[model samples]
Target: MKSLPETLPDETNALQKMVLDYQSTVDQLQEKLKWYEEQFCLFQHQRFGASSEKCPDQMELFNEAESILDSLKQDDSDLEETISYQRKKPGRKPLSKHIPREVVRYELPEAERVCECGHALHEAGEDKSEQLEIIPAQIKVIEHVQVKYGCREIGIG
Candidate 1:
């Protein structure tokens, strides 16, 4: 776009204001045109550019599954099939037995051991879990024992 004609130094105030407004409108239009040009370029690229999902051999797109199967068959002939191999189960490794254990029993008191149905609770079973305790210059096992009690009469404890 050609540059706007410069306003004369002695031009009237109204004329100068009109020129300034026209210049601003021209600048805004130019900016909009540049933005439209950029959009056109991007659109052209997207419509015509090489697509990542497109197959290198365009003819194979129709028979992609068959091509894959053929390739797999060819690959299988060159590969060896394993019969058996031992796989270790994933779990937390057991703590060392050498560590001295401090047994902490979580058993119910003698008074509380009685069932709510007036029947005395009997020792059913217990669950034992161990945690490693780290003290300065010393490592020991803290064994937690949760004793279970059951009321045979009410079948609840």
Candidate 2:
């Protein structure tokens, strides 16, 4: 049977230093937390300023700061729990895999026209409207070119 080797004094000293380093990181995190809180308050005040009454940019900043503050608070809590109890709470959920819907715009050529059958025929109208359908995530777009003669006799070949 093999006996386990005991920890040397040097190893113990290194471990103690590592713990102290972690403690310093926790202190720095606390300072950052305070700064973020102050920024959040400032953003809120800007959003509700009397001059504008409601600044959309300021409101967006306020919301972003608030969310970051919440995340920092969760991180701080997790850090404290790690230091004292060596355990952490569950963190934020991963992003969803679903693709988001997007609005796509395309300009039809000036030579396009609408036919009696409700189909937009080429070289018929200046203005055209279409309700584009959303393509699936896996689908790809392809474009094709077509040329037609106004008179069939012009294309006898």
Best by TM-score: 1
User: Taking the tens digit of each residue's C-alpha lDDT, what string does model 1 give over 33-56?
Assistant: 999999999999899987675677
Off by over 4 Å in 1: 1-90
Judge candidate 1 at residue 54 and give its lDDT. 69
lDDT of 2: 0.56
How many clashes in candidate 1? 0
Local distance difference test, per candidate?
0.86, 0.56
Writing each residue's lDDT as its tens digit, candidate 2 over 98-127 gives: 533333435445455444444444432233
Lowest lDDT 10-mer window, candidate 2?
Answer: 148-157
**Residue 80 in model 1: lDDT:** 88
- Model 1 worst lDDT run, 10 consecutive residues: 1-10
TM-score of every candidate: 0.44, 0.26
